[model samples]
Target: MYRIGEFSKICRVPVSALRYYSDLGLLPPESIDPESGYRYYSAGQLPRLNRILALKDLGLSLEEISAILDEDLPAGELRGMLRLKRAEIGQRVSEEQARLARVENRLRMIESEDRMPDQEIVLKELEDVPVVSIREVLSNPQDVGMLIADGYSALMPAGIMPIGACFSIYHDPEFDPTALDVEIAYPVAETVTDVPDTPGGRSFERRVVRGGRAAVTIHQGPYDMIDQVYTRIGKWISDHELQIAGEPQEAYLTAPDDPGGPVTEIRFPVA
Candidate 1:
């Protein structure tokens, strides 16, 4: 048996924490002297203390940890809870990484603002193109690639092949990266009827992407840096006194496996 301070040293936990746990009935000492009120913990209680510390590290609340310890929760249920916490942490890390990338990109752009080259902006009339497409609201912009890949996989089995580049139409009136309203499409020579939906539940439909006079420019780098091109286009539109008439679209010109990122043509309908 070891006194409270000695046990604290052995377990590498604070004596105050041990006392608090005892008060909460989480890790009570094995014995206590009634006259002098000294708490002693036996080596047998070490396993229980370790379990409490492990659960706390897994992000569980004190109340939740107490319930799990007191009720002797099943191992399977505890494993499931740990898995859920892991996924939550993973999602937060992904979001933070993306946010950090954006911050770094912005800083770089600001530093090079003066020496930025003028991107060529073309104004031309586009003809109507028929396509097979799926429109969905995505919670994360990163998922757009998977959605496009899934669309192609679904179409290939139906003998539908794209005659031209795959493209995406931004349907939202205002840009919202977190909840993007996008339409992924593949241009077909002719519209086919009754195409089955993707296995992921996105319904495929045949539609004509309306065309009009548009301002277009090509972006040839990471998608995260595409915003720089968009900024130039917006300035060009303003300088030319043109008003945007519809949602923008991006046509991918390179294969998905391109190591340097896809070369994309961005178009904005204008009046």
Candidate 2:
């Protein structure tokens, strides 16, 4: 048997930590004095202390480590827990990587142009895709979200996940401030036979968006500034001697409520 101080020296863990672990019922001393309240630990307890420290270094919370140690958890259960931790860390790393890329791109843009361009348009060939969509004549532009949500909600029951970003296809040749003809669509991997009805009793149908050549540009910031991006697209199409062959599309690349900045891809079909 070793006194608490001696045990702490041998295990290389502080007395406070040992006390904390003991208070949590993780590792208790071999015995405690009845009158003076001194604690004695056995050399055998060193192995348990080592395991706790090892798990702590692996980022496990004290509570989790306590449960794992107290229950003498099975190897499979421990592996499962570690797997979940790994996945969570991996997701964080991926998000950081994307942020890093954006930072690097911004640096390059500033160095080359003295400032970032308002909008950079490029031609891209969009491929045909299967989509579940809702066609609506929205009373105002603000109602776009309602239609998008309705389209997604109606399709969610089919258990099919969207393959890409949610996009809207404008059907009207010219713009109307109060009335808009829009088809909101979410691309899905597989087509569903059964159609679902929106909250307003409109049928959500599965259709293939045709493949075509279009000019695409990413708009960063609020939706209110999106019209400027469309202006650039129109100028680029005319410079290339191309005419607008079909309606414009806007694909949302980030959450609408993102505080940093929301990314929107504006595309116009050209021939």
Candidate 3:
């Protein structure tokens, strides 16, 4: 049996700190010397102390750490707690990564703005994609991509080739700029998923977007410029008082520009 002093020395923890921990019933020593009133600890307790230290390093209080150890928690509950912690950490990490990415992109934006090209652009009356769609608010990223792909897959087995390309029509920045309230759709045979014979499983009024129809030029390039076209089209709309009807839709004339360059014809429908 090692005295408190020797035990604290071996554990590289202060004697006073170990006594406090013992008083809190966090890591009680193996025994106490009755005659000297000294606390005695075993070398075997080192691992437990190490675990406490590690948990403390992870921002857990001694009380929390002790509860975790003493609770005799089921494997599933413990796994769930750990999974929640991991998800929290992952979000923090993603936020940091996004911030870094945005900073880098801002640098590029600055450089690009300095070399701004006067790429002549225009707007035209765009065609609508006929399909069945489900409007869902996207909060979970795991479901966002799957939402569109699953919608397409669900539509494809019905013998309907999407007339327009599959793109999300965001009403607002619901989640974040990176994530938003989006409408994912593909042109089908006015199909319905649940409501049989309903076009695209949902019904929206067939209305032409009223706006300042500018000289819309189509770009056979990349998706990145798709947003840029919106920006340009928006400016034209504002300058020309051509109000927009709905979220501008892009009718993909052909396959997207492979290896990343420009879109084929990003049509901005205007009034």
Candidate 4:
């Protein structure tokens, strides 16, 4: 028999942790000192403590670890749980790698910030998106914001989802920013038009958020001054031996509506 302090030294675990494990019924001692209320663990419990530490390192919850130790789950279920854990770890690893790559690219840009020319657009085959839309006219730029919020609110209750960027199609150039007819949509199944009298009308089509194939320029500024962003993109395209093919789409990475952080990002579809 080993006293709690001696057991802790052998296990390299804190005394408080052993007490906690005991309280949680995870690793109870064989006996206790009644007069002093000190814990005394058997030499046999050392292996059990090692297993608990190993399980903890694998990110298993206490309950799961207890269940596993108790042999409550079958082998198949255990394998499935381990597989899910592996997939989750793989996803996190990929995300970290991508984040590191972005940071390195940004560092390079910062080093050459002064000599860095206007942004260049890359062409990519835009994926097909299925969207249900509501045809409404925006009274002003502010109304665009409200309409989007209202659409999200209305669709959330109905379970419609937005995929990438929530935006509008300018029906006419004369379409007033003060009074513009815009369609707010989210990519769902192409056939999910009818919702037994949904808030928005039915009849969705396969429309690729086109013109993304054109060269794009990123802008970091307020939404009101976004027109200057367009001008910069236009100049960049002209200078880079590219031509305009489709109308510009402003994909909001961040918006000026929020109090903190700079609003940025607009994509110009060009030939």
Give RMSD (Å) of candidate 4 vs. truth. 11.2
User: How far is 213's C-alpha from truth in model 3 (Å)?
Assistant: 5.5
State which candidate, 1 or 3, has the greater lDDT. 1
Per-residue lDDT tens digits for candidate 2, residues 111-217, read 99898776777779999988888888888998998888877776777576788999999998888867899999888876455666866788877889997998889
Point to the candidate with the largest lDDT: 1
Q: RMSD for each model, in Å, please?
A: 17.7, 12.5, 17.9, 11.2
* lDDT of each residue in 209-236, candidate 4, tens digit only: 5334665556555557666766766765
Which ranking of candidates, highest TM-score first? 1, 2, 4, 3
Against the true structure, what is each candidate's TM-score?
Answer: 0.56, 0.56, 0.39, 0.50
What residue pairs are clashing in model 1?
none
Write down the lDDT of every candidate, Cα atoms only. Answer: 0.88, 0.84, 0.62, 0.66
Per-residue error (Å), model 3, residue 63: 99
List model 1 lDDT by residue over 1-271, tens digit each: 9999999999999999999999999998998999999998999999999988998998887777998999889999988878888998899998798568655655675698845455677788998999989999999999889989999999899898889999999999888988999999899877477688898987988999999999999888788988888788887677666789988999999997888777999999999
Tell me how many residue pairs clash in candidate 1: 0
Assess candidate 1 and give its TM-score to the true structure.
0.56
Question: What would you estimate as the lDDT of candidate 1?
Answer: 0.88
Off by over 4 Å in 4: 114-166, 169-248, 251-271
- Candidate 2 C-alpha error for residue 211, in Å: 1.3
lDDT preference between candidates 2 and 3, better one? 2
